[model samples]
Target: MLYFIGLGLGDAKDITVKGLEIVKQCSRVYLEAYTSILTVGKDALEDYYGRELILADRDMVEQEADEILKGADVSDVAFLVVGDPFGATTHSDLVLRAVNAGIQYRVIHNASIMNAVGCCGLQLYNFGETVSIVFWTDTWRPESFYDKIKKNRDLGMHTLCLLDIKVKEQSMENLMRGRKIYEPPRFMTVSQAAEQLLEIVQNRRERGDDLAISEETICVGLARVGAEDQVILAGTLRQLASCDLGGPLHSMIVTGHLHPLEVDMLQIGCPGRNPCIKYSYQDG
Candidate 1:
């Protein structure tokens, strides 16, 4: 049997009881590391689980998945994923492969940022299509996600922006030389995301496109979510651009028409003496 288990957002202890049991029983356990990350390192997880975990990078999971799935039909194998197994489409593909190989698999669910984001008080039902904000380069700045944010704003729904995280990426120079060397991992911070969004907004304005969002648009920046040191700040896009949300794995919420209760809840994270004073229904 093949088990795809989800390790919830924090440390190794966040694994569900059932997931922990499965991990202990599995003959081989592989941890999928590229999609998202846990607050603790592999050593911490190994210590808690009392089992060593094989780190499965992108190449191993995407290119050599059969090796990981081999003999799963006869023996118990566990593939651990940060957040829920279904959060990323790659895991679904793995399941398909398991099925074709006549391997029976079970998925154990856990908390992911998609659902845990509501800790900031935004109603889950009010969220529209989620969009990803990628790292912008000198000549490769893509603003395709802006259209999705605009559509959500048009319908008075909030937009959840999943910031980009580049892990084990090859540098252009290395790729040109046909070298397999990888650059360091990079996790996009909230401030960087805000700066990129503001730049896009400026570009759109210069092009004479009346955008639904602006510099004064309300946004919620969350960092290290589900961790003990997690930080959530609520303010305008302009304010967030200058705000320092220490640590990696940040996410942003572009709010639309806010409810009175949401406004109250979000204000708790706002900086300054009078947080709620700046935000009013008339402002929206």
Candidate 2:
């Protein structure tokens, strides 16, 4: 049997009891290191799991997944994902492979930022299609995500922006040289995402295009969610661009049609809220 288990978005103890039992019994356990991350490091997880885990980078999971699936027919192999196994498409592909091979697989679920993001006081049902904001290179800037956010906003729904994370990425120079060298990992912060969003909006307006969103739109910046020191800041997009939430693993929400209850919740939840005053374009 092959077990795909989810490690919730926190420290080592976040693992479910069933997941821990499976981890201890499996002959091999591989931790999916990319896509998402926990607040703690590998050593911390190893100490709590009582099992040394093998780190599986993107290349291994994408190009060499069969290696991880080997020997699964005869023995139990465990694949540990940082969040719910299905949160990433790669894990879904893994499930298909196991099915084709006639190997039985079970998914052990846990909370990911997708749902856990509600801790900021936005109701879960109010969220629309989630958008992923990626790091834009000097020569490669994509703005399609802005359209999705506008669509959500027009429908009076919130937009959850999942920031990009680069891990074990290879530079073009090294790739052409056939070198295996990898660059350092980088996690996008809420400020960077907000800055990119602001630039996109500015570009649209400069082209004489009207936008549903603007600098004055209410936005929420979240960092290190599900952790003891998590930070949630509510303000305008302009305000969020300069605010520092600290550390990696940040997410942002472009709010729409806020209920009084949500405003109260956000104010109560935000330690730095100054009891944040909600702003809207209409206030102008």
Candidate 3:
């Protein structure tokens, strides 16, 4: 049997009891590292879960999937994901491959960003489609996520902007040289995403369309959520663009006009940034 276990938002102890039992029962345990990451390191998880984990990079999971599934045919194998197994579509692809291979599989679900974003005091049901923000290169900046965010905003629904994370990625020169050099991992923060969004807004403003999101739009920044030291802040998009959210694994939310309950909940969540400062177009 193949187990897809979710290591929930916080630390190693966050794993469900059933998931932990499966981890110990499995003969081989692999942690899918390229997607979202847990707050603790692999060693920490190994010590806590009492299992030796093999780090599975993107190449291993995407290109050499057969190797991962090989043991499941003979014995129990567990593939652990940072959030829920299905949080990233990549895992779903893995499940598809496993199904095609006729491998018996079970998914153990846990708290993923999809639902954990509710910790920000926003109504989960109020959210519209979630969008992912990718890293922009000088030659390859894409605005595909803009339309989705715009669509959600136009419908008066909250937009959850999942920031991008680049892990175990090779540099262009290394790939060309066949050197196998890996670049430092990067996790996009809420501030960076806001800056890029404002850039797109500026471009649209120049085009005289004026539908772009502005800095004054109410935005919430969440960092290291589900962890003890998690930080949540609410302010204007512009204000949040400048705020230091601290550490990796950040997410942003562009809120629609809030309900009275949402306003109250958000105020309680953001004790320091209360009054939730609004940005102005005039400042821009």
- Please give, for residues 1-284, the per-residue lDDT of candidate 3 as tens digits: 89999999999999999999999999999999988888899999999987799999888999999999996977999999988999877888888889899998999999988899898788999999999999999898898888888888788889999999999778899989999889999999988998998898888888897574776788888888888778888777878878887888999998875777887777667433334444332321
What range of 10 consecutive residues in model 3 has the weakest lDDT sum?
275-284
RMSD of candidate 3 to the truth, in angstroms, is 2.5
- Segments of candidate 3 deviating more than 4 angstroms: 270-284
Give each model's whole-structure lDDT.
Answer: 0.89, 0.88, 0.86
- Alpha carbon lDDT at 282, candidate 1: 34
Q: Which has the better TM-score: candidate 1, or candidate 3?
A: 1
Off by over 4 Å in 1: 270-283
Report the C-alpha lDDT of model 1 over 153-239, residue by residue, as the tens digit. 999999999999999999999989999999998999989999999999999999999888898899888887888878788888888
TM-score of 2: 0.95
